[model samples]
Each structure stands twice: as structure tokens, then as C-alpha cells.
Target: MPDLAYYASLPRTRGAAAALLLDDLGRVLLVKPTYKQGWFLPGGVIEAGESPLTACVRECQEELGLTPRLTGLVCVDWAPPRDGVDAVNVFVFGGSITAAEIAAVRLPPEELSDHVMAAPEKVPELAPAHIARRMGPSLRGLAEGRALYLEDGRETPFG
Candidate 1:
């Protein structure tokens, strides 16, 4: 087995930034990628040397054509490794958009096929299992005013 030191020295996992965006009606916004079957939150892979926060903001603008000002980080999920891919570090941030902002949103044709504003209670059902697990807890963390750590989308220690 590899030593702790060896593990510590391993390559850092790739990461992505996700935004939990809410509207005046308190509905959460989720996006459907043109390339995928399921809906997802506003997010994308973090580019080299870019901060997670910056990535979230950039992705929102790219995906939804809105300049989101994220309030704070709500969750940091260390997604389980899969299919030769290293574990993904997912960062979820809290944000909101005004009615005008919502009206101004222009979905990027190449990235998204559709976008929905689901009621808070319906978000879990709209997303996949992994996304649901993290989003549920992350929204709670946003409501309670704290950050939540997660592993495979489940709440983790040092939260």
C-alpha cells in the first residue's frame, strides 16, 4: 500500500465550480447540457490556475449569460474517483438573480439545451443521485449559514 506521504504527493484532483442560483420565487436554477441527458447546476471544469470561485462566476456567465455574484461557498464535495478519472473536487457557491437578471439570461447554444427553475422541494428530484446528495446538503448549508464538506456528494467531516 502507498504511504501517507506518497498519497499526499500525488497529483491534485481536477475540480469544478457550481452555482446554486435562486430567483425571487425561491426556485433553484438547473441547466440541461445539450450533450447530456440529465439536468445540472450552473458549473464547469476549473481551468488551469483559476480559482474555484472565479470558475463558478465564469461558468454562470458562459452557461446562462448572467454575471452572478456568489455570496459564499456552501459545499465542497470530493467526488469518488471513476473510470480512470481522479476524484473530482466540486465547489458549490450561493447566489441569486433578480427578475431583470433572469429575463436577461441567454443560454449558450453550444453548451445548454434547456434551463429550469425548480421549486426548492423539487430540486432533489430533478437532479441525479450524486448531484442531489450534494445539492440538498449544500442548500441546507446556505440556509444555515455555514459550509458543508462532502465526499461522493454525502456530507463529510470537518464540515
Candidate 2:
């Protein structure tokens, strides 16, 4: 068995969780982070001792100011390391937002800059490449009541 120091020295991948929220018009909700260049799903990095689902719910409440009841897993994407950044495993959950909930959204200016309800087709234009690539499969998975496993945002034969 590995010693505690050995285990602690092992490489660890980052984990993040996001919500795939939709409105009555079937438009997806996207948020622009003040720290990033492109739009992204409503979520953030998973904290210590936090499950993916719990992180998703907590992030949604913190970012959108609404505690939505997330339904099911939509996608689990493994983004390979790039530009010296550690690899990240992203878990996405599906949920719907009512008009009232949408109206109640309040972004913390220090974190998020803006939010938009964009048609599914427009997601690719607004989000980062990885996020855009993951959107279609995620949506399909949601509609089929199944979850997708993706590598670098593309579905693979094996997880």
C-alpha cells in the first residue's frame, strides 16, 4: 500500500460540475464569467469533500441565485490536459428553470458578467470550444434519459 505522502504526491485531476438548464422555449442558459473569455454552463470547480451533484447544486445557487432541482446526469466529459493545465472531469446535470426562476437570477458581478438564454444552435458560437462540443451530445443524452461519456468533449466507444 502507498504511504500517505506517496498518495498525496500522485497526480490528481481536477473536477467540475455544471447544470444544463433550459427554459420553456427550449433555449439553454449560458453564463459569461468575469474571469474567462467565453460563455459557459452554470457551475464551478468541485470543492473538497463535495460530490459532483452537490457541487452542481451549490454552484447553481451561487451563480444563478436559484436552487433548482436538478434531474439527471447529462454528460461526463474528460478534458485532456492542455497548456500545462491539469486534466479536468466535468459532470453536467439536467434541469429546467421557470420564468420566475429566470427572473430571479442574480449574478455576483465579481464572478459572472452576464447571462443569456440562447437557442441550442447558438451555443457553439457563444461557449468555449470544449463546452460547445459537449453541448450537442449532452442535450441528446438528456432527451434519451441517458448519460454520455465523452473524452475531450466527443463521445467515445469506451469510457
Candidate 3:
């Protein structure tokens, strides 16, 4: 009755943005959420009216207490629907942290209970499979200076 057809025609999807924050030592930043099980990147769900890149920076500040100087796109993943949930579009951006930025870390206690700076090789063991797959390639792409289009975590020709 109230434009139900219009709503039905719209794509049902969610979006999130994450920062691939690397230190001078080439370690990646990981945050432990009190509400979640495994370690994840310094990022969260993108809010409506917010651009993906901007959401990445915002989440970093909210979670880590430092305004990361985000640079290039790392990888964009199109994750299919799971458990009847809408599909998700995840964007990861590469950002390097200065010593000053590291010094400014003041994690929000209520959200994050712990943090880790892990070597590249250890990211897979640190995060869940979906994230692990993405992080490895993201770190590589950051170093190789290229961005990738991915489905879930694997780089595929089709998105």
C-alpha cells in the first residue's frame, strides 16, 4: 500500500569498513571485542549516509582512539547472504600508523578488551576464516601497491 513494491525492488545489503593498519614494523593491528569471540581489525559496520572510506577512519578513531591516516583501497569483498541475512559489502583500506598515532592509542574499554599487533604470517591464526583469507591478501596488496576485488575473502573475477 505504501510503496511496498519500491522497497521490494531495492537491494538488501549491509556494509562494513575495516582498516588494515600497519605499524613501522609491518605488524597489523587487531582488536578484541568483548562482545565477539575472535580478534578482528580496527573497524565496524558502516552507518547509513556514511561513505565506506570515511566509515573506516571513523571506526578506527572510535575503537582505537587514534585518527588513522588512511591511504589506498586494499580489497573490496562481496560476501553472499548467510543464515538468511542480507549480503554484505566489506571494504578494507590500507593505512600506515606513525609513532605518534601509536602513542595516541586509547582503546574504548567497554568495546575492546584487548589488542594485538601481529606479524603478517600470524593473522590467519588470529582471526576467523573469512577474515583470515582477506587479511593475508590485503597485507600483500598493500605492499605490492594494488587493490583487489574479492568475493567473501577469495579474489575472484566475478563479484
Candidate 4:
């Protein structure tokens, strides 16, 4: 195994996000962020002293306004820091929601402006570099109910 500590030393702390996978007739749910205008899964950082699982669930509810059935954690991505920022560890949880319930979800104005559903093959056009890399693999593992290990130091899986 690679030296996880080498990468861990680059960032002082970890930030978490939930990659909410809403399976819609073989399609997945994604959001186009207002600030960045790129495709991304629904999730946000874990608050101070908050559990990753709790934060994942809360973020989905707050951002999308839908209570999804969180199946399991599909992937863990480490994004090394650029400039003086901290590295990010995004915990993508596999989940499911209904198409009818999709319309009921609401996006926070500061975080996002709109949402869309796309086949996995079309994900590259919408996702940020970090996220785009893992979208397909993560979705596959999530669908299969297996955890995908993304412990690569050279690759970034979330932006």
C-alpha cells in the first residue's frame, strides 16, 4: 500500500461531502452548482463535531429537501490541497430516491441553482474534474453494494 500518511500530511484536516446517488430509471441525479456551474452530486461538509453519516444525511435533506434511503458508503476520495487550502476527503454515500419525489427537493441558492438527471456515460460533461473521475466507478460500486477504494495519491476524485 502507498503511504497514506504522506498525503494526509498535506492537509491539516478533512472535509466531507455526500455523493447522493438517486437512481432514476438507470439515470442518476446531479446538481449544477451556481458558484461553479459544474455538475456535482448532492452533499456538503460535515459540521464541527458532526458524524460523517449524519452530515451526509442532513446535507441531502437540507440541500435537496428529500429524505433518501442511504444504502452505504461507496467511495472515499482525497483531494490534495492547492495553494494554502486543506485537502478534502469526500465520503460518497450510495442512496436512492424516487422520480416523483425528485420535484419536491429544493436546492439552496448559495450552493446550487438547478439539478438534472443523466445517464452515467454523460456524466463527464457535468462533473468537476475531481468528481468526474469517480462518478462512474462510484456509481457502479454503489449499485453493486460494494465499497470502492479510491486511495490514489496521484488522482483527484472531487473538486
Q: Per-model C-alpha lDDT, please?
A: 0.86, 0.92, 0.86, 0.76
Indicate whether candidate 1 or candidate 2 has the larger lDDT: 2
The sequence of per-residue lDDT tens digits that candidate 1 reaches over residues 1-159 is: 769998879888799999998887888889989886677899999999999999999999898888897789998999887758778999999978787877788998888988888887786777777888787788888888788998998876677
Please give the TM-score that candidate 3 achieves against the real structure.
Answer: 0.88
Candidate whose lDDT is highest = 2
Model 3 lDDT per residue over 17-40, tens place: 999999899998888999877889
As a whole number from 0 to 100, the lDDT of residue 7 in candidate 3 is: 94
RMSD of 1: 4.1
**Candidate 1 runs further than 4 Å off:** 1-9
Error of 2 at 91 (Å): 0.3
Instruction: Determine which window of 10 residues in candidate 2 has minimal summed lDDT.
Output: 150-159
Better of 2 and 3 by lDDT: 2
Candidate 2 global TM-score: 0.94
- TM-score for candidate 1: 0.88
Q: What TM-scores do the predictions have? A: 0.88, 0.94, 0.88, 0.82
Clashing pairs in 2: none
Clashing residue pair totals per candidate (backbone < 3 A) = 0, 0, 0, 3
